[model samples]
Target: MDWFYGPMVQMHALLAWCSVGLFLVRGLGHQFGGAWVMDERLRTLVFSSHLLIVISGISLWGALHHDPLYEPWMTAKFIALGVYFAVGHWALGRGEFRVIGYLLALLALGYVAAVSVTRQVLLGL
Candidate 1:
């Protein structure tokens, strides 16, 4: 792989880990009877991180297109990211939908964890 691809993948990997951390903080804040963790700055950070993660992840997937088992995780990551972003948007919006958004965020975290473990998502698809 070229230097750019390696670093790009590395950045995505790092962002994935950072997202996990952010999700955890958000979850803990909610679970422990605190405020929403993705308030303003954290929300912006999460948004940027998520966007970059997706972009970098896609680039990494393209770089590994020749490989057989390189797509499953990418597809799953995309779906997971979609949910995460949607839920986060709603959660930060206001009103009764906030709780549902929080729940979705938790599910999003679970999906992220799955992606991390599986490392291959779009198999045969």
Candidate 2:
């Protein structure tokens, strides 16, 4: 298992960025009246990418052996993940609030990145 850590980390990071990029593309395309954004194939790809991201994240968590209950940063990341998912749902939906939701989702992603890097629940504050 020790030898698996490096590759797993790389895989998880790559999948995370890929998911975000796909979301950005979909959101922008939908906003700009691109019907292709709603294509079944593309939706499936996005769904698959997100599923992989979650799977890889859990794998990494298990590999690291970090207890989330004892790690404030992990707890923060979990909360931010929930926010990202909820806002992402709204962002990809039909409504005037879509723009706001999109931006908020991005913000939540940024917070997750920050916490991941700094391991600080409070971040800059």
Candidate 3:
């Protein structure tokens, strides 16, 4: 966990959280018709960062030689990631489902953070 590993992981973590802000912007901008938020370039940038998020996650996983499939917290976080992607898709689309997607994305963000902090898949337990 030296410079290459530690710094990259930290950078990716920062990127992930920043992406969360972009997620909020994209979702909220839908209601406000914010030009930058609705821009294709913004969407592309945000989506592209997801690739980094995945790559960093895998890199860290490999660095630790950790198997997420057998790890309950990691498993749950992955599940939440899936939900976030699905909901984010809907959130990016047009029509009534956007609201649902927006709320779910927010919840998923919180869930991911909580899981990471608590090291617990089941939050209350």
Candidate 4:
């Protein structure tokens, strides 16, 4: 299990970054009128990557024996993750709200990243 921790962390981090990168590409492409952005294969890849990210995150949490209920930073990250999902849904959907939703999703992601690094619910404060 100890050896699993290191690899799990790496995998989770990689998947997280990959997920964000895919979202950025799709979001930008869709915004810029790239028809390929709506391709089923690309959407499938994005979905698969996100699924892997969640799986790896849960594995890491279990390996670390983390209790999110008692960990403020973990709790904060969970909340931000929810916000990311909600806003991300709208961001990727068809509507004039897409741009605003995309920006909000990025902000939520930033908050999650900051909390993960600093382990602070209030970030710099």
lDDT of 2 by residue, 24-108 (tens): 8988887777899889999899889889888888988987898889999999999999999999988888888798999999999
Winner on lDDT (1 vs 2): 2
lDDT of 4 by residue, 1-125 (tens): 86898888888888888888888888887777788987999989988988898898888888788998889899999999999999998888888879899899989999998998899999979
Candidate 4 residue pairs that clash: none
lDDT of 1 by residue, 58-123 (tens): 787678673434556656766787788788666655456577787887788677667666675532
Candidate 3 has a TM-score of 0.88
Q: How would you order the candidates by lDDT, starting with the best?
A: 2, 4, 3, 1
User: Which stretches of candidate 1 lie above 4 Å from their native place?
Assistant: 2-7, 26-43, 66-73, 120-125
Against the correct fold, how does model 4 do in TM-score? 0.93
Count: clashes, candidate 4: 0
Better of 2 and 4 by lDDT: 2
Cα deviation in Å at residue 12, candidate 2? 0.3
Q: Candidate 2 has which clashing residue pairs, if any? A: none
The reply for model 2, stretches above 4 Å from the true place, is none
Which candidate comes out best when scored by lDDT? 2
When 3 and 4 are scored with lDDT, the better candidate is: 4
